[model samples]
Target: MRRTWLATAALALAAALLVAGCSGQPLSEREKGTGVGTLLGAGTGAIIGAAVGHPAAGAAIGGALGAGGGYVVGNSLQNRQAENQQTQGQLQQQQQEIENQRQQIEQMRQQQETE
Candidate 1:
């Protein structure tokens, strides 16, 4: 019984390490959220499944559903972020145009004063 417990602990630790090591690049907020949701869902599912004497099946189903839901939410958030970036770019462009117009007006005024 003690050996079995130790093995389980080791396996869990290894799984965690695997997940942590799989990424070199920092995850975006959306990916982070999805990964968190998936991990949490799988853990919850496993516990519930164990109580019902079918932990493996429970974890599988739970993980799949959780991942799908997480992906959808993450994708939506990413889209919003992209949209915000585009809006910011547009605002900057407009500001530049306004500055150019001001400069042009100043140039015209100076020419008139000289004449």
Candidate 2:
């Protein structure tokens, strides 16, 4: 029974790792975090469940919790990235305005000198 349980757990872990590594494109930060969390959670849960003679249940619970946590973290990171991009855009606009004002001032000074 113990050997069977161990084998099952090992198989589950391998499958999880394979899924995580199979994606061809680079995973977004959130996806990466979620994948990592899910795998870790599943493994940990399996170990605990095996201790209590319920490895499958433990893995399910752990995977759910880990995925939820990863989603939240990923969303937060994405929001931060968006905010940073907005700030940069605002700064660029401000710089352009400043340059335009400088140009106008220069034009006025040249006109005054000519008059």
Candidate 3:
């Protein structure tokens, strides 16, 4: 049983390395996002595959799915960031308007006091 477990662990490690090896190039923003997912998926797949006796196929499918998922997540995060910036800008504008109103109110109060 110990020997079997050791062999399984070794196989999973090798599969993980193989998946890592497959990814080698200049990563774009999308690719970078996908990379983390892919690595995690590959590791998951390796262990699952080893346990179920289909390590290579599982790893391959997992890597592909992970990359696709990661790209989507990255795109979503980027969109959300842009939306936040726009909201911040609008808030700033609103704040400036409020300041102007406060100043006008102060001026009116001063005039009434003098009268």
Question: Cα lDDT of all candidates, in order?
Answer: 0.74, 0.78, 0.73
- The lDDT, on a scale of 0 to 1, for candidate 3 is 0.73
Q: Is candidate 1 or candidate 2 better by lDDT?
A: 2
Better of 2 and 3 by lDDT: 2
TM-score of 1: 0.72
Tens digit of lDDT per residue, candidate 2, span 1-115? 6457556765876686577678676666677667767777777887888799888788777877877787778777878988999999999999999999999999999999999
Candidate 1, residues 1-115: lDDT per residue as tens digits? 4346435744774586477667786667577657766766667767788799767655666766776777788888888999999999999999999999999999999999999
In angstroms, how far off is 25's CA in candidate 1? Answer: 2.7
TM-score of each: 0.72, 0.72, 0.60
Candidate 1 steric clashes: 0
Q: Go through the candidates in order and give the clash count of each.
A: 0, 0, 0
Compare the candidates by lDDT and give the number of the best one: 2
Model 2 spans with C-alpha error above 4 angstroms: 1-25
Q: How close is candidate 3 to the true structure, as a TM-score?
A: 0.60
lDDT of 1: 0.74
